[model samples]
Target: MSKHQKIVIIGGGTAGIMTAASLSKQKLKIDILLIEPSENHYYQPAWTLVGAGTYDFEKTVRPMENVIPDGVNWLKDSVVGFEPENNCIVTKFSGKVDYDFLVVAPGLVYDFSLVPGLGEAIDKGVVCSNYTDPIHTWKVIQEFKGGTALFTQPTTPIKCGGAPQKIMYLAENHFRNKRISDKSKIVFATPGGVIFGVKPIAETLMKVNERKDINLRFGHQLVKIDAKNQIAWYALAPNMTEVNPKELEISTNEGLVGIHYDMLHTAPPSVAPKFIQDSPLANQEKWLDVNLHTLQHTRYQNIFGLGDAAGIPTAKTGAAIRKQVPVVVNNISEMITSNTIGDKVYNGYSSCPLVTDYGKMVLAEFDYQNNFTPDPKLKQMLIFDSSKEHWRLWMLKKYGLPYLYWNKMLKGIDV
Candidate 1:
């Protein structure tokens, strides 16, 4: 006999756990099975702070068993394939598992191999990434003695678009505190033409760059790293076609340029997980093909998706998952009770807390259209301008948000 569940949730990350918790609290008496292989769950937003030596690395993780919602079955198995046509999933250990409804939230994968020599360079002298090991990142930053420090952003979509720069700002603060700012050359090399996608945030960041005396290299994508020689290679990305006088673009057609650095911090290129990419649920871009608003699968009515792997046009941050969890849960509830998808829709809301310095941050919140969409509740809570860097926002990032996440968000209480 095949194991079966009324509702099957894939991946126990933020999206899946939150969804399961929300459903468990509801009066709906459907049996829920969550398929996840990992033994521990991570609060990834804190990794940036951890890398900057602002937070403890251990605080960002917890036993997976501790967070799995009560009354839900936890299947410690990996999903290798999806049989959406028959409402079944193929797992590596459990074999075939049938479901009445399915939720896909396997998250995304970081492709360090995309950059030649990068895989071997991580956590090895002078080269580190917050995405991989925040502890080693802090170690590298602490041990730096002031030379050409290079921070890079990959061309591929990452979890937090602003993360690459957040660590840089912290390192700048660290270098300044150590009286090495004058001797160090801080460079931020990114593939994007603008410092930030949102114009207001970008303008604010430009001012920060000026204040920090950081060298901004736009239209540059990291391709390779010579770890032993401490050299980084970049390919010139195409210029922005949109004619905005306020925006600037590099007009160089130079095929490649190599820069020598004493220290390097980079986020590896991110892509959809291989299983999701190989599945039929994936779109042309290989992301989970879901209705952006409803979070429901386009082809399969019984399936829904959220989080980084979903094809939502917004920054893939934990704040995005916060808004998405409610939408997906409500829609699934409607489908179960009324046999119709709910009208509750996701607005593609995403937030990136850009840590500018030791105790200041610019809370960049936006929607699908890239409009500055700050949380009204957060505005009232902090009582400060989120567009500008403020210590209150930093406190929110450092203290308040973590409490809210562990206590509220994971428990499925919509904050």
Candidate 2:
């Protein structure tokens, strides 16, 4: 009977922590147990800034016990499997844990083996990734003299779609300030054709790319990394432009193009946790299958999911989680109180702060329909036209968001 839990939340990451805190703040007279294995809660959005050397990595993490809300109970154990039918979850250190309701928010993890040498090459030498080690990325960025600097991301879905190019833009600016602009060539090779999905944001970034003299290689996926030779190989991705992709400007060998680089910054392939992918809760893409708006499991009424692990058609950033948490919390609160969920629906809102240079950023906010939606409060703050780059947005990225995450969001205040 002690193993029977009232409300069990899997994962203590942003999603899990925020949900538990919000619920605890609601003063709901119920037991809530959060299951997580990690000892630290990371503020991952700041990693981009850390890679740019504009922010410190130490400030981005807090002890797990420090951030957990006062009332919510935390169980330091990893979930090995799930039995949604029986409303139960299996743990690694513990046995079967049954719960009246469950919240599955275990976030995404990396799988660098997708590329041949990426797993072994990352953070070791010239190959550096902010996702893995922002400190090493900064070190590599500073140590580079000048040549071809390659930036790329995997074809798989990542947390921030704009991160691969953010560091590139920062590094480009750094090179110019260091008097190496004439000798440096920055290249952004991505599987997607457009610089960004939103029309206004894409247009602005394309212009930024042009102004910085950076090459935008569309529909090129990182297939292999010959780190010893400092050669990055890419394949013509499925979305490759048909007319004339190569343009005969870069080197092409056999069917692949090998771009020799002085420094390479790339994100490893990311996917849902293995236990989740193998569980019944997963969709075809192996992510947690949940209603886009309600954040409730498509099949299991007593379960819900959000954050990077949810199979939502939106950017998997903290901003998206900001919108998702309210829906999940409200729906669950209604279910617990009235035995019926409310009409609180999430519009798939997500925001990406695209850092173009060291001190400049563009806040790209949109819905699931790919429409550019700006926050009205920005107008009150005398901030408008987020499609264009601004330092104020950079301020928000560097300081404002982090403040909210620690003071308000983690405590379930929601601003």
Candidate 3:
């Protein structure tokens, strides 16, 4: 069936719901349709705590119907293809949906197949990831008998870049409490050269790594896993420039390195959803092409994109979406009412609550340039230096943020 909406939102995720709710608050007298396939909505930021045995997994989720805005029409279907020229979408469950404007926030898709042996071994035995199964991760951590515990980060952009290491710190804390720290060797293998993007936070995290004795292996990417043999293989990233010809020559000859692990936690590689990748609106990188500042589609003014799917340079996190929602909503409303884009610009503001230990977190807020950008209100509310690890930030991560997300952000209260 072909039905038309004044505004059609693809994906009932954090971005879509907030946009609809924000629009609804304006009382724009426009019909909004939200398309999503999942029956549940997840508060993904808390997954790190869930994997570390701090937060409940059930609390991170809610019925999709419960969070959807009051006035928006919910289409319980997945979009298979986009027809931007006709201003309609082809869905798997619903035949066709036509719209005056479209909002794309379908988020990224996890590709386990990117790593050989990962697709078959994930959430099985000692191989577990917080992204897929936090319960299994907790179980893996619980059953650990003090050996090499390896946590890996993929080369691809993940939802929360700090998550791969968050659980590692928690596991280290767990092992210390269990008196197995001496017996366990915790190693963080990542492709990035530093622990974090921001300098101050990275410097602090470097010290945290030193304090925890967590071995950091930079310029390494997970290429394969041998679940049966309990071996994880990594490919060393090639040097871009041949500064020292002899050193570069030696490094280039290296092969896949293997490490034995008793416990392994990984954040799988992620990419744009196939539907978004196949669309005409996708950028060269296969992500939804939107103006980074305006959150408006570059090619089609009527289309807006946000959340993880938007091809923005900043780190993809829920906190980023929290800031992005208002920008997209206001611009869309202005366009509908004034027939011109809003002047308000998004400064590429995004945040990551880096959980350092059981009761401590480093609230890392930054902009596109990787400069530390703390929320003054958040700083005042928590009453602590956001750059330093504090229990207050942990409390915010464990309790306050989730509450704010459900009650205020999703409700379009704009906190």
TM-score, each model?
0.95, 0.96, 0.94
Summarize candidate 2's per-residue lDDT along 1-415 as a digit string, tens digits: 2332388899898889998988887746568999999999999889988988999999999999999999788999999999888889999998999888789999999987888888878998889999889999999999989888889999899988888998999999889999998888788888898889999999999889888988778888888888888888899876775221222236678899888888999988999999999999999999999998898999999999999999989998888888888898898888877789868999999999999987789999999998999999777656789999998888889999999999998888875
lDDT (C-alpha, whole model) for all candidates: 0.89, 0.88, 0.87
Give stretches of model 2 more than 4 Å off. 1-5, 238-254
lDDT of 3 by residue, 1-415 (tens): 4333389998888888988898888847688899999999998888999999999999999999999999788999999998888989999978989989899999999888888898899999999999999999999999999888989978889988999999999999999999998888888878887789998899889888888988777878888888888788878777312111111101122487777788899998999999999889899999999998999999888999999999999989878888898888888878777789887788988888999999999989999999998888865765557888888888989999999999998898877
Model 1 Cα shift for residue 130 (angstroms) = 0.9
Cα lDDT tens digits, model 1, 1-415, are 4333399999999999999999888778589999999999999899999999989999999999999988889999999998988889999998999999999999999888889899899888989999989999999999999888889978888989999999999999999999998778888888888899998899999999888988888887788888887888888767722221222222222567777888999998899988899999999999999998999999999999999999878999889999999898899888877889998998889999999999999999999999998778866765566889898888999999999999999998988
Model 3 alpha-carbon drift over 4 Å, by segment: 1-5, 239-254
The parts of candidate 1 lying over 4 Å away from their true place are: 1-5, 240-254
Mind sharing the TM-score for model 2?
A: 0.96
Task: Supply the global lDDT for candidate 1.
Answer: 0.89
Residue 87 local lDDT, model 3: 87
